[model samples]
Target chain A: MKRTVPLVITFIVGLVLIAAMFIPHWPFTGLDSKFSIFYDVIAVFAFILGGGNLLKVHLSRIQNRRRDWKYSIVTVSGFFLMLGAGLLKIGVPGGWTGDYQADGSLLKYLYDATFQPLQATMFSLLAFFVASASYRAFRAKTKEATILLLAAFVILLRPTPLGYYLTFWLPKPLQFLHIPNLSTWIMSVPNMAGQRAIMIGIALGIVSASLRLILGIERSYLGTEGKD
Target chain B: MAEEEKLTIIERLGAVDRRYVFLLIAIAVIIPLVLHYATSIPTSEIVQSLFDKIESLPGGSRILISFDYGPSTVPENQPMANAVTRHALEKSHRIYLMALWPTGSRQSQQLIDEIIKVEFPDKVYGVDWIHLGYKAGNQGLINTLLSDFKGMYTTDMSGKPIDSFPMMKDIRTLRDFDLIIGLGSGFPGTKEWIQFAGDPGDIPVGGGTTAVMAPLLYPYYPKQMVGFMGGLQGAAEYEYALVKKYPKYAKRSRIASTTMGPQVTAHLVIVAFIILGNITYLLERRRKRKYR
Candidate 1:
């Protein structure tokens, strides 16, 4: 009964929101906003579930003396310390009344000194990964591969002053053979076409996924079997 | 070689060493960037459309500029934001700034400080422009603002009331603004702006986004979205247009074209790697067939 009630509510709300998109009138105009507020309220409650899971996982790891138990200890300690600092407003000038990130506050200090740098470092990893991925994926072995390779070459040359120099000797009518022109053609036409195709696929995928959820065919997010 | 006794070139081509490709691509990207190569590629129709939107807006039209991206996409998105801001300010358009991302608020503040506050001190905050600061409700804040602008955001970044500002008097919803510019990177970004604000409100919206996200937005162009700038190349084109139209901004900012040098080189490197991979696959196939 507990699960059934919530599922019923979900089905009704989900349909209403979808229908609201087409309806331009009053109450319907505000329906989307109200639904968003409702989702926010539920998400706030779900944070408790997340916190409980975090505690359970780390505590069990520490108690079991699991591999990398010290890491668990650090995680648990840091979690509590941050929580306490935020809840109690530790080292915040003028106590809890002032902004948590007010200049000279401990929260701000920790964020700037520790969190900001950590975030930046994680983001920087993308550059290395892009290089690695590009190296492996960009290979040519067939007619299609050769075409892709050549297109890539033209695109690459088009972006540099060197491209202009290389194609400078070409006649006025043959200027279209320049690397820059070739690159622009590849991106605007071929790239745009590929992007549109992928977008359509993604859109269809999203529609299928959303429909599955609305019809109660996808229950995995509820921590249960896929089938309801 | 007999068909049953030997592998074909196509099969061999499929089995190339990936490392060789990677190495080749690295060379392709590095050489151009190191050499400081520059090219003057003619602008595309899409980029020109975006330029026209800014150009057509009457001088001093009120525009809302939302910086909805963070440092992660600063490389791709910042140039567009700067160029658009410069274009608007140059046209004498009044700007109302806001951000959905927490970090974006600070980013917006930085732009105001660096560009408007410093360069154009005569541009007053309340009358000429205002920063509504960051709101945490994501699209919900946008949804609310559709009906009640003051309900969600009562004050500006400096604690000034919306009512106190003369510019915001008739601004009951997003429709009041002449144009809505969203510089976005990911979720709760340009897409969300289109869904929540532009489509329903019927407001004309245009903006720039990271290359990765640009593909997803192409379907909405010239329809829900007036125009869009994609990646570093798009930014360079916009920068090119701005400098040619108003040379004053040419000195103030050159973030887009400067970054294009690296971007172009990187693209070339990727192409080279692909070619090397193909050649290696073909050669290995030939060698294997001979032995068999």
Candidate 2:
């Protein structure tokens, strides 16, 4: 009964939402939006629990002096500092009435000064990683691999002035076969077709998985046996 | 000498430390950035289509610019955002900025504070541009905005009422806008816009996404999206077009083009390394064959 009740509720709600998309009747017309608001409301309350859990876990790690607990100290401090600054409206030039995102506020200051730059710094590491990964992995062992290598070479050259120069001397009839032009064709035609194919497969998979869930066949998600 | 000869090119390459390769790439990036190199990147049609879309739009046509990315993507997406906003503002299009990602709102505000306020001070707020900030429901926000934008954005980014903004007066729905462009790095971004609003409302849409996200969005081009700018390269190309057409702004900020020098150099370094790695691989294979 413990699992059965929840499954029933899930089936009913899920079916209703699915039906709502196409029906557009009295209850169904705005049900998707109404449920979205319901989700937002629930999410707001869930955030408090989420925030509390974050604080608890990080604080415990710091207290116990676990491995890399020092990083937790930074995380806990940043969390509370931003929260307090935002909630108390601390150091906001517009005082209590203004937007929490107002300039001269501690929250905004920290976000701009620390968060923005730090995020950019983390992302910039991708350049090094991509270079290292490509050096080690981009080998041409097979016909397919050779094609891939050639494509990569063309794509790499396409964005640079070097690409323009490489094939610039070609005759007018062969102008469209230039590296830059080939790059465009590769992205728009083959790339688009591949993406679309993947998207279609994903859509079909979702439908199948969703149906399984609806029928209670996807019981793995429920954390216990469906028969139980 | 025979022992040295026995060492295959692959063995020699294997002995070469990875740090040297990293140092070479580092030099490649730094040199191009420090020294200005004249690089004429011919505008691709995809980029030109986006340029033409803005160019043809009648002045005062509402153009909604959605800042759908956060700080992690700022380097890639921000320059494109700058170029797009600059072009739209240059064309005298009324701007309405919004965001799907929570941090996207802040990123959008950065553009306004940095570019809009400083460069185009003559452009009045409310009348010229308004920021709807962010709404939480991702696709649901688009769903609501399709029918009634007022349902979601009752106020501007600040604590000001939307009614006060002259630009907000007529924007009852997404359909009312002349064009909607999304600049994002991931899900709930251009894909969401393409599916939810653009397809349903038949509104012209465009995207400026990170290169990683660009390939995924191509199916929508010319049909769902009029055009798109892909990553820093796209940003650079658009910047080139903008500057070339309006030579007056050639001296103004050009971040993408500046970054492209490093971009091109880095690509070359990677390509060279790949070739070197392959040579080692082939030599090793050949040596194994001879032994067999």
Candidate 3:
């Protein structure tokens, strides 16, 4: 009965939200927004679940003296410190009445000195990873590989003054063969087509997933996997 | 010598070192970036289409600009956001900035301060446009706003009620906005805007996304999305269109187009490496077959 009740609620809410999209009546149109507020209320409670899970996992790790348990210490410490800073508004001169980062707030100091640099450093790692991934994946062995290789070449060549220098002598009519022009075509036509196809697939996937959840076909997220 | 001679092109292709490809891509990206600041690449059609959408909107039209990205995508997304905001301001469109992501509120604040406040000093806060601030619950927030915007968002980021603002008084739902411009890097971005807001409400929407995500949105162009700007290239294109219309903005900002030089060069380098790797693979395959 417990499982069935929630399933019924899901089915009813999901269909209503879907119907709200097409129907423009008083209650129907407002249903999406009302559901949104309802979700927010649920999410607020869910945060407690997440927090409890985090505390449990880390506490267990520390108690067991697990390998790399020290990292958990750092994680827990940072989490609590930030939590306190946010909750108490430490060093915020206006006693929580003013902006959280008024003048000497800990948040401002942490954000500027520690968080900003850490975030930037993490983002910078993408450059190296992109290089590494491209090196490993961009081998040309087949027809598709060859095409990708050539397209990549044009795209790279077209963006620089050097590309112009390299292909400068081509006749005006053959200027379409210019690297920049060719690269534009590749991105707009082939790249756009591929992206659109993937997007459509993803859209359909989301719909299927949402429907499954709504219909109670997927209940793993509800924490009673076999009951459904 | 006979065995070596018998090795085919396909066989030799297999033995290419990956490091060389990495080095080439690095060079490709770096060189173009260095050159981009010195010169500019021509804009593309997709970007022009995005520009036209904003341009065509009547003056004083309400535009809902949702910043649905974070710091990770700021480099790619920030430029597009800035360009779109600038275009709207130039057209005298009232900008209603909101965010689905938490950090997105800060991003929107930066835009308000950096672009609107700094550049268009005459633009008022509540009357012209306002920041609706970040609300959690991702698409759920969007879903609620679709029906009763005032119900969920009673006030602007500041504490004033939506009813207090003259512009917002008439605005009841998502359908009221003339255009919805979503700057998205991932989930709950352009896709969410299209599904929850655009598809259902029959509101015209557009988006700016990272290049990797751009292709996925093409099918929705001129339909769900009025137009889209993809990565740095799209930003550059939009910048180009903006510059053509309002030349002064060209001097002020060229974030997207400026970055295109590196993007193009990097793509080319990857292509070359692929070819080199293929050649080596073919040669290596041929050599192995002869030996067997």
Give the per-residue Cα lDDT of candidate 3 at A35. 74
Q: What shift in Å separates residue A204 of candidate 3 from its native position after superposition?
A: 4.5
Chain A (alone) TM-scores for all candidate structures:
0.80, 0.89, 0.88
Q: What CAPRI-style quality would you assign to candidate 1?
A: acceptable
Candidate 2, residue A61: how far the Cα is off, in Å: 2.7
Off by over 4 Å in 2: A1-13, A41-50, A63-65, A214-221, A225-227, B2-9, B38-40
Q: Model 3, range B128-230, lDDT digits (tens) per residue?
A: 8788888777888887788778877887775567788888988988999999989998888998899888997899989999867776777777667888888
Q: Candidate 3: where is the Cα deviation over 4 Å?
A: A91-95, A101-105, A151-158, A161-209, A223-228, B1-36, B257-269
Q: Which candidate gets the maximum DockQ versus the true structure?
A: 2
User: Highest TM-score among the candidates is held by which one?
Assistant: 2
lDDT of 2 by residue, B225-264 (tens): 9998998888888888999898877866478877888888
Clashing residue pairs, candidate 2? none
Which ranges in model 1 have alpha carbons more than 4 Å from their true place?
A40-56, A59-63, A72-112, A143-154, A165-177, A215-218, A225-228, B1-43, B137-141, B158-160, B267-271
- lDDT per residue, candidate 1, A1-228, as tens digits? 546666777788888777777885667757765676556446556666888899999999999999999899998987787677666777877776655555566665666676556666687556555755555566555789668767767755665666778887898898777777766667657776887788789879999998988887876666654434
Query: Candidate 1 local accuracy as lDDT?
Result: 0.74
Model 2's DockQ score: 0.60
Q: Rate the local accuracy (lDDT) of all candidates.
A: 0.74, 0.84, 0.77
Per-residue error (Å), model 2, residue B97: 0.7
